[model samples]
Target: MDDEVRELNLTIDLCLRIGEVLLSSGAGAADVTATMQSVAHHLGLRRPDTDVTFTGLSMSYQRSPEEPPIVLLRQVKQRDIDYDILTRVDHLVRDVLAGRLDLFLARSQMATIVSVPRSRRRWAITLGWGVMCAAVAFFLGGNVVVAGTAFLAAAAIDRLQLLMSRRRLPTFYLQVAGGFVATLFAVGVASTDLPADPSLVVTANIIMLLAGIGFMGAIQDALTGFYVTSGARIIEAMMATAGIIAGVSGGLSVGALFGVSVGRFDPGRMLDVEGLAIVVVGSAVAAAAFAFSSYAPRRSLAPIALIASGATAIHALVIAQDIGRTWAAGLAAFFVGLVAYAVAGRVRVPPLVVAVSAIVPLLPGLSIYRGLSLLADGGSGTSMGLLAMITAASVAIALASGVILGEYVAQPLKKEARRLEDRLAGPRLVGPLRAKGRPR
Candidate 1:
């Protein structure tokens, strides 16, 4: 009985650790719970129940009908999206399910997986963030001067965010600080006689800020009936956005005091395509750079870049036909999800990682920034500001839901394939192959 209890505890511990890593790395709640249950069952535990949410996970296991159940819970406090970690845990689960990894070895590997040491060099990460923001400016039709300003401002913001994080500042304040950092740069540049579009700098940096939030995950949770977790994530996104608004507003106020004028942006030229080839190519580079910011593996960058460029091309094509921006974005993101599913297999990465990274270029950062800019200017166009905000929200939900629908269409067969791999006794591609003449 003592040995059995110890084994049960170890199994539960492994499941909870895996669940924590998956959830933190932005895996959907359903996937986390299902994966945990599958792992527990494959490890010889009977009738495991797993509950997943935005913040934490709880799992229980029973050995026999007459025996009392062992319940275990883990509260996940830190949530940073690291696709590399998610992929590792995902592969580990498959290996365990294939009976290649035993319980004892699994526990040790789980510890290493959860450690999550950053593999990419620090300078590389900073360069990635800077280039990504600059590439976004180029994609948005900014000139050389505007892209340069965006690159510098984004680099500074990334460094500031790192410092704030080291000081253990709240994320809300960090968002505010980041917004202020970018706006301050924009206003300072505008105050000078530099021949640059300062507005483009703000727009690019805003997109970077918006890109880091899990708008897609939030909408996915809501649509899938995980209301509580969805609500939490929605509120968090909103607050982070609000922080950016507040910070930008404050910076603009200071600029007004210094006699600097931040003019309203003209929306007519936002999607112009006179030089669209540059935009499309830059979108690919920007998407890959953003993925690196989240610690995605180097091998996955090429596929992610291709997927993002395709989505951008579709979005630009649809918008050229006079389709609504919201609808165009949705269509493009749906295609991204669908293509990611097929390409992920070839690239040996999960579809969600590719889809999320690919869709980064299409997020409604410009719309959100435009709305906030309007509101900061004495609230004269309040109705129009509200409309822009609504449009931004619509685009966000559309992007997320489109991806979810595409995954839903692609996943049934994939799940069946995984199950078949689990049941097979022969050598398989994903796990360690059976030794020749050793078993069966």
Candidate 2:
């Protein structure tokens, strides 16, 4: 009995540790809970009750009705976007479930994954962000000069945010600072005789800042019935977005005082064939660059790029038919969801990495910025600003819901049918849908 209790304790601890990594790295609550359950069951603790929240995770197990339940809790203190760590831990979970790794080996591997310092150079990540924003410029039909300016602006934002992060600043303030720097840079460029559009530079950097917000995970959690976690995520995303608005508003105020206008953006402009091709290439480059900045595995980069390109093409083509932008975004996100699972399997990374990175190029940064700009202008523009903000929110919801729906359709039909039979089951983005030895 004593030995059994000790083993149970260790098993639950391991499960909680795994859950912590998954949750902190932006996995949905459903995925985190399912992965934890799988780990505990495979390690001989069947029927362990796992609870996942935005801030923490806990698991409990009882050997018999009369015995007191043993429980363990792990707090997720930091939320970092490290796809490499997520991919490594995901493979570890698969190996353990497949019986290729025993409890001891699995635990040891998790330890090393959590303890080892990342070898990726900070400067390289900064450079990747720069390139990503540059690609966003091209996607928005900006010229080479605009792309170069966006590159410099993004590099500056990244370095500033990095320094602020080291000082333990909150993420909201970091976003504000990033927005301010991006806008100020664009204003400076507008003041010069440069032929490039400063608006595109600001818009591109806005996209870069918005890319990190977990709209997809938030919607996934909500759809999966983890309302508490979903609400928390939504609040965080909104706060970060608000910070961007405040910072950009401040920069615009400064620009106005200096008689420099950042100009308005027309998102409704239709693209020709050559322009469409540039958008596709830009989307691919942006996705790959974002993956690299987030420390995604190199093996997964090409797959992510291809998926993003295809999705962008779909979105562009759909929008050309006079369909709403929200619908276009949803269609694109659906493609991402449909293809990401198979691509992730081939690349051996979590589908979340591919899905999130692929959707970076589709984030509604332009709408958000345009909304804020109009609101800043006030008067009749206030209504238009509110409308733009509404459109941005709608696009975000569509993107998240569309991706999850695609995952639902793409999951193996047999397993999905069984899961659907259960009233509580949700789509899996980061774990095996069924436990080992469970009937298919």
Candidate 3:
């Protein structure tokens, strides 16, 4: 009886740990809950009840009606984007589900995955962020000088945010600081005689800041019926974005005082066929660089670049046909969702890694900046500013929903079609869709 009780406790602990990692790494509540249940089921815990919130995870199991339930809860304190850790943990879960790894060995592997330091140095990751911003500048039709300025501004923002994070400052404040730095850099550049567009630089940095928030994950949770967790994620993403807005607004006010501006927003700008090749290359580089900055597995970079390039081409082609930007973005994101699973399997990483990274280049940064700039100028342009902001929100929602719909379509094509075909079951982005072996 004592031995059985001990085993039960160990199994619950393992499940909670797995849940914590998935939740912290930006997996949707449905994915986390499904993964935890699969782990518990494989470890001989029949019918364990699992609950996932934005900040905590809990699991409970009972041997029989005659005995009490063993419940365990784990709090997720850190929310960082380390796709390498996510990939390693994902592999560990698969091995356990396959019956190749026993309970104790799986626990050991999980511990190492969470405890080990990242392979890339902090400086390398910061450099990757700089490269990503530079690529975004080029994608926005900026010249080499503009790209260089964006690169410098992004590196400085990363370093400043790092320092603030080390001091244990809140993420919202860090975002504000990053926005301020990016805008200040743009302002200084505008005051120079250089022939670069300061607006492009600020827009690029805005995308960089927006990329880290989990807008996709938030929408996924909502679609999967995790309303509480979805609401929490939505609030968090809004708060972070609001921080960026506040900082950029402050900087724009300062720039106004200094007689320097990022110029007026142009809503009519569209991608032309002449520069399509350059934009495609820029998009690919931006996606891969973002993955690198987030510490994605080295093996996943090429595939991510390829996927992002394809998505960019699709978006450009659609936009060239005079389709709405929101529709174009949704179609591109749908392609990302459709292909991410097959690509992730080949590269041995979670599909979420590929999907999220590939979609980064398409975020509505320009619209966001345009709206803020107009609002700041605030006379007759207030209505236009609000319209731009609404457009930005629509694009964001379309991107998230499009990716999820793609997942819904793609998952049923895999071997787990039977389980995934159930109306109540959501697509699996981070865990096995079907358990491997029967309970012991």
Candidate 4:
């Protein structure tokens, strides 16, 4: 009984974590709502028969087996506010009413989080994938160093581009602005006669970095069984991905006007070990860049970054050896699942946040770009695009599934703890000690 209550509480915490991750990841309200619904469903919080509909920013829930049920409107920027508060109230009420005061005090306790301003301990706390990419590029291959450096510089340019974009600028205008800056930066490097291969690598990586911008939200929506919401998420993801293609295509075309032709990519070059490793590092870097782009709490990046670096190394190793991306993805997803679960359990944090953060490196942003560009240019391998699509889907699915799996692993232990508490709490007291009304 006590364990069940704690799990409910865990669900609430997970909800807020989902919101923060989404917000920091640049997710829209639809993403946030879908994530909250998924968290709620996983915890079994909603009534089995309830009809719950989520708008991107708010929600309408109707609890009923009724022919007609009343709508309960909740319009909050964050989704899980009431759920968390009520979980606390639920535990307290249940304990007092059921004569189970001892339940909460047992081993496996819950704690509240205080969101205080902390120092920016970037390395100590913010171990994200970007730095991992830097290390891989720095150590494994000289060409990669340039690619990593250019990508970082391009990301900086993209951030500045957002300032011009904030006034509700035309989508093309904003994208072109960002892409142009990135392209120009690479062009300047090209003026020094930088090698075509590394320059192309960096340019291509930048282009792919922008794919699946709202994957977490979209996948969360789908998992929560909100097909409509998930479809919207998919469309949004597609639009962003298309924008990436346009930005890259436009920038490449414009750069060639100044004699900086974005070099033609050669698929044969990617078969080498260094190439494969850099790809994995690039994956981790994408995740880091996403969080950095979103202005997440500066302190919480190190461990995540470290995890990314390690995950990428494994991913790269497998792929370079002609092993499938799926095996590597599963390996990466398992560590991610464990970290997300353990951290959430220990610190009252949310698994969704960690899941989103960790999986950024694994998204198939590059594959999507290469696939689409190939199609546009009348190249073969139509299946490459499909592979990229599946790669992105599989990674998200792996992440969500892994986290859910970890939670299932956690439930029974919590349940046992709760049962022990209930046993210790003894039976309920009868009125007047049962024998003689109040005279006993």
What would the per-residue lDDT of candidate 4 be over residues 314-387, giving only the tens digit for each residue? 66666666767666666666666555545533433244444556666565544544554454444456666566
| Candidate 2 lDDT by residue in tens digits, 1-440 | 58888888889998998888888888898888878877787888777788888998899998899988998888888756898888889999999998999888999999999888764898999999999999999889898999999999999999999899899999999999989999998899999998988888889999999999989889998998999999999999999998888888888889999999998788865255558888899999999999999999999999999999999999888888888889999999999999898788789898899999999999998998899889888999999999999999999999999998888888755443455422244667887766432222
Best by TM-score: 3
Query: What local distance difference test score does each model get?
Result: 0.77, 0.88, 0.88, 0.45
TM-score of each: 0.91, 0.96, 0.97, 0.59
In candidate 2, which residue ranges exceed 4 Å CA deviation?
Answer: 413-425, 436-440
Candidate 1 is scored at a TM of 0.91
TM-score of 4: 0.59
Task: Report the Cα lDDT for residue 151, model 2.
Answer: 99
Please estimate how well model 3 matches the true structure, expressed as its whole-model Cα lDDT.
0.88
Return whichever of 1 and 4 wins on lDDT: 1
Q: What clash pairs does model 2 have? A: none
Each candidate's root-mean-square deviation in Å?
Answer: 5.3, 2.2, 2.0, 11.3
Q: Give the distance in Å from residue 278's predicted Cα in candidate 3 to where it truly belongs.
A: 1.1
**Which prediction has more favorable lDDT, 1 or 2?**
2
User: Alpha-carbon error at 179 in model 4, in Å?
Assistant: 4.3
